[model samples]
Target: MPGIRFSAQDLAATRFTCSRLREVVAGVQVLKDAGARAIHLPWVRQARAALAGVRYELLSQLVPMPARYLPDFLSPMPAATAPSLAAELAALTATAPAAVRAQLERLPRPLPALVADLRRDPAAGLGRLAGEIQAFWTAAVEPHWPRIEHLIDGEILYRARRMATGGPAALFDGLHPKVSWQDDRLTIAQRRRTADLVLEAGRGLVLVPSVFIWPGAAFEADDSRHQPGLVYPPRGVATLWEQGAAAPPQALAALLGRGRAQLLAELAAPASTSELAARTGQSAPNVAHHLAVLRAAGLLARHRTGRTVLYVRTAVAQALVEGGG
Candidate 1:
């Protein structure tokens, strides 16, 4: 996608900040909670763990030198034209280097331009954006292969294969997630187990790539049209960081509006749920329940400052209210 508006230098200054990084971490936690059921948390956990081994390399590839060069290269495209970009990406991938070619091919077939356009307009080209992103990353960034191939190949790719397929076959067995494609409306037993766990945990879901969890899972539309990897979350996570506001009546509205707003106003600083309830004249149980929900949703987080759990609103929560997401 076109880069966000920061200059190369400014972009370089932007390390994935606490706000963004925390969202990812929170999402991971929620996913783990959900995966406890037949959903298979181990698979997702393994995928994330594998990522740690190569995250530095992946980050380097994403945040390259010539600092702003990458973002500047893609800033002007209109969002609506993302599909066209996807088409461009698909064409480019036709000749990607062998090592990266396979990765590029696994992406949903879409235009790179279209994906880049998302930086300008997130919802513009919804259909093939993910594939286009995969293609673009492989083509634009894969050439500068860091010495992290062993991790990517041995860990990331290995875990991804396990998630896509169903077994931990020997590496030489050639059984891999990238090579597995289920087209018959089937469900993996492991995935179901994991999902059960997540629901029981009472949180949102985050899908990660692992030995038994497929990060590339896509779904067809009501009309039964085939959409590639990235089926859930309707819109990719990038949408939360893009221009327009998210679909409203958000996951945390109960704790962010005027009523809750009053409760927050009463607190000079962090306060316990019981304290908030007393000030707001709401029952402690109700207040506590809302607090837990907000914390799980990333709108708020709890920390132990003393003898009580202190609740604090997160920046993302404020941004969402301001229509910045």
Candidate 2:
């Protein structure tokens, strides 16, 4: 029952951002925990194949299957809204040795030797930890990084619009069933502890949408934080690896054609041309052409975030995609 008691200052400071590091850590966690596999079965199987022989024993042990608590340092809150792997890894590498040891010492142990070594020499241990994560990313994450990034970006965009139109409730309510915002406070349900910790004067908050953190959510707030963060699974993880296009209502497809219908079917969660291309096995130019036509027909709404322009179904498009037509 841990919660963040937000002040006016905390609410003003809150913003949306996504992380690559979190997904990397979550991917490792999925591999370590057997029961957690069902949440992202497609990803777990694909990652298991990709991570073959990857030296993540230390990383996996640290985030054991049925985790009690994962050390905060692994999922560092990046200063940037959308941080690259290098930036996240650098943040991990720069952790203060004392902070690292304190978290490790608190772990339920007889610690693994590597973890013990890490607790003994945090600076050196940090280097090894970063090395393993970087290796894991290179092997399992890099190939799918674009699709993951786009999905998280689209989630932020959808939530941003929801907050703008419907205020905080619309934004927080969709995050996870266990996460809820009332008054100015945000409460996170924990599996074990029943006590809630309130932060009266938080610097800011980051909501990190993860492709791997499905079926659960995690949040943190402490004096050490410049910003508190909640990492929740993004909304459309089920479609991340899915290839079957949504069956557009027959009438809609008849009007829009099979190609554009397929494109429309896939945009339930906004995506860029490149992301759609990858998702549908189409060329980027082909996706772009279809998106242009969809926009012209008033069936899609385009919104730009950073350098990417995402397309989501307009109300009309939504009805059609749902077979209203």
Candidate 3:
């Protein structure tokens, strides 16, 4: 079992951010797993076909095992509230040669020639790797990013509410079956490794929510070089790739007309017009039209977060959904 002992300062400094780099890294593991562990994620199966032509052989070799050690430099912590994929690729490209060499050296089966080239001209080596990552993302992730982002955003929202209402203990509770909270310590159960981390005040812990890191949580706390953090599967991930529209109740459909009612029912959680369209198998224009009607009718409300507009059910909408059901 790996446990992190949090100090008062670490608790105070703890924060959450969704990482595009992490998602890409985890996707590598998913691809290597060959859909065994991620059997429930239909998107993973779809991604495999999409990424067949990508030159991901190197990444696949790097992450042969899911729960094993992965090079830390591959997925650094996000530097912004919602870091874009391009920004993350740039971060990888900017990684110091020494750091890249260090991580490459740590690989169980190091590629001697690749390591030599990276150490010789770190910028060029890392630049090529970053380009590969960008290609991988385009083939395997960009298409499904809206749904992925919604899952991550929903998890962050839930964690915020937990922390606000129940403090750290409440938020940590049930984060994962293997995770336990007591005595200001966060313990993560690991299959073949164990460590105790004592966090310092200024260092702080970063809580990252991952959609693909299922079944177990990962902890990274090595010296002062990288911020201590845990990457755990977010809540409600079981339905991440569950297909088909959320069918509206007959009563609600009759009352609002089928298209509008279906849109409202799908808005049980916050979603953008594009996300709604993708999930409900409707066109974006059609979804936007229904959303406008619902908003005008007081059944939906839109909130702007960053560059995207997310629509959520209002109190009346929730009541109607429940009553109609």
Candidate 4:
């Protein structure tokens, strides 16, 4: 199992971030899966149809197999709080020719001619690659980004609460079955081989929660050039692709009006008014009215991020949903 040995300094410097670039990179893998493991994601099905006209063959060739170790230049550590896709694509375009060749040389198998061309003229090659990525995002990701962002934000909030209440160890808890934290060492169970990394001052672990990298976790700590980080799937991902609102329990539906009760039940995971309306087949105005009523009653809480307002069940509401109230 590969383990990251955090010195006292490293532990103190560890931090968490929700990276846009990382998500884009991981999303490519999800597309490559072709709904095999991500059977639950109905969005993937739609995305595939949307992307049917794009140059998917070339894009998939660049990503290759063993999707974990993608070229670092393509998805560098995000620099801003919320990096725009343009910014991430620019980073890919900026890769030096030599660096691109170096990464290609490290691939386990012989490089395809298209990829080898990257070594000859990195700027042109990377530009083409960036265009492919943009096309993919526009076709497969942009339309679904709001729902995806909501899920990511909810995970971040959940982790923040875990850290606040239980400290560092709590942060590692339930991250993945293969990951464990003990005696200041963050261990990741790996099949290939064993390795250890000691973080120096100013070099901290970046914890990134991923929606696409499901059923397993990945650790990358050996690269001295980049900040070490772990990419693990966020909780509640199984419900990510669920198509429509489930029927509320009969008793609960009878107690609260069916509309409000259905909204409450769906609030088990955070969702915006638009998302709720889309899921429930209700108009946005109607959804907002129900949400406001629930919020006034202390059954739900509203969180504003950017221009979007997300609603989640409060403990009182959760109890009600669970049939306790």
Candidate 5:
């Protein structure tokens, strides 16, 4: 079979790299050389799991890490392309379950419109909004903590880059990647392992399914969006398991301290600095000071709404909340 032609829509549709298209072609040859019969694409894996009627846990190991390497191809697009859950729920309500539909109704309505605005105008400054929605989902899923962790670990196994230089722990610690369970398959979307913006997973042609390919890279929807997507060929595979050996108690404390706890509790709903202050019972200025500190820590972020700055916890922050570490 001939290779698929590339286009801008393809670039935006998926999340992996196209610059190394030749490498992908070569990798496919290597896969065929290895005597593997039918190759399982990323989406196929996901669909298989969904058909099982249970969400299969992907690479959960990587979920604890921060999103260190985001694709630079479309940095200007919103971090999340899909409109807010509220918006998607409204669209899917007719067919969605009552429980799921109710969950969607709980979200703020304007969130999706704001996301669209950010997508259409890069300078709209919706990063904070993105952070808030992400936080909300993180917090909302606490009841399903075990399942989420399993999904992340599954994603790690599916997408974690197999490094020749170090073991899984070292590579995981060093890279600090994000893993997710999409369509019931675990997925690891590549991020900058370092400042170079090199596609770490793509470089080795490992079994790491390129988010850039099939389902495309699932970024926060900031830029790098295209359709008909690009894919990275598989090579070696690394497993993402739960962080087996626990870190020291102090380390855990630092991760889920008073500040993070307070922030997570408040971010259940998007709130401005003043609103957060009111909720925390702290003076507005004092609340503002802490908000700034949290944002710098990447635990909380800010968004502009009208004349005020809305603050919310980040996914990492919620991870700490969920992990209690």
Candidate 6:
């Protein structure tokens, strides 16, 4: 149980954003745990096969099962609200050896050979780790990044909307069962809490909503160099890998072609072209073509969340789906 005292300046600086690399990291956490398999079965089946050929011996050792404390270098606070995986990887590889050694020594050992190697020659080891992560990114995360990005962006927007009317209390309230905010202090229910970052100026709390780390939350803190962040599961975790919605109404399908109508029906939540393709069993080109046509017809609207574009149903499309007009 640790309380983060946030001064007025800190509150002003607090921002909500999503991380692509964080999702990749969290996916690893999910893949390693058996208990998470049932809810994430769709992804588990796919991710396991994709990851089988990747060289991640060191990467796996860095984030051990029952992950407690991970090296901050694994996911440094992204300078960009939406950093490309390459950028995040560069940051990881650039981690000061002193910092790498410090974090690794803290982990309970016997350290795996790869992890121990990182401490000995961090520059070389991290390069290999980054390469492993890149291979992993291609297999497990890149395929679903659009959907993951959409989900994270939507959650941030939802929290922003809540804060607008309900105030900060609402923004954090029920964010996670283990988190609470009051008296200009944000509290995280974690085993260890340090307040060094709280006293620093201009470094606000960074909020990151994640998908694979559902049922738990992670808090990160360090000196001014690293931004303090909290990574928690987003609200729509259950639907991330869900198949398409049920059949679109026949009347709507007649008005709009069957393919387009089906796409519209599955978009009660905003989604990317890739996401729609995965859920609906359509090709990327086909889904992209349909989304463009739908946007022109005013049945859908697009919003850019970081690097990904999300298409949500417009008012007209909503009425059409609900049998209104």
Pick the TM-score winner. Answer: 2
Span of 10 residues, lowest total lDDT, candidate 3: 58-67
Task: Give the per-residue Cα lDDT of candidate 1 at 75.
Answer: 17
**Mind giving the per-residue lDDT tens digits that candidate 2 earns over 239-276?**
88776556566776788897799888888788888778
- State the TM-score for model 1: 0.21
Worst 10 residues of 6 by lDDT: 193-202
Candidate 6 local Cα displacement, residue 219, angstroms:
1.0
Return the candidate ranking by lDDT, descending: 6, 2, 3, 4, 5, 1
Q: By TM-score, is 4 or 6 better?
A: 4
Which prediction has the highest lDDT against the true structure? Answer: 6
- lDDT per residue (tens digit) for residues 1-325 in model 6: 5777787777778887677778777778888884754678788899888887787887888888888778888888777777788888888887889989988877888988888888899999999989988888898889887677788777776677678778778899989988998877788878776542354666778888888778889888753586788889887677777775547888998988888998988876677887788788889999999999999999987878757788877767989999922
lDDT of 3 at 43: 71
Q: Give Cα-based local distance difference scores for all models.
A: 0.33, 0.80, 0.77, 0.76, 0.35, 0.81
Predicted candidate 5 versus true structure: per-residue lDDT over 20-46, tens digit per residue: 212222222322232331233332333
Per-candidate TM-scores read 0.21, 0.89, 0.78, 0.86, 0.24, 0.79
Worst 10 residues of 1 by lDDT: 220-229
Question: What value of lDDT does candidate 3 attain over all alpha carbons?
Answer: 0.77
Please give the lDDT score at residue 119 for candidate 4. 67
For residue 150, give model 1's deviation from the true position in Å.
49
RMSD of 5: 19.4
C-alpha RMSD in Å of predicted model 3 compared with the true structure: 4.2
After TM-score superposition, the amount by which residue 165's alpha carbon in candidate 4 deviates from its true location, in angstroms, is: 2.2
Compared to the true structure, candidate 3 yields what TM-score? 0.78
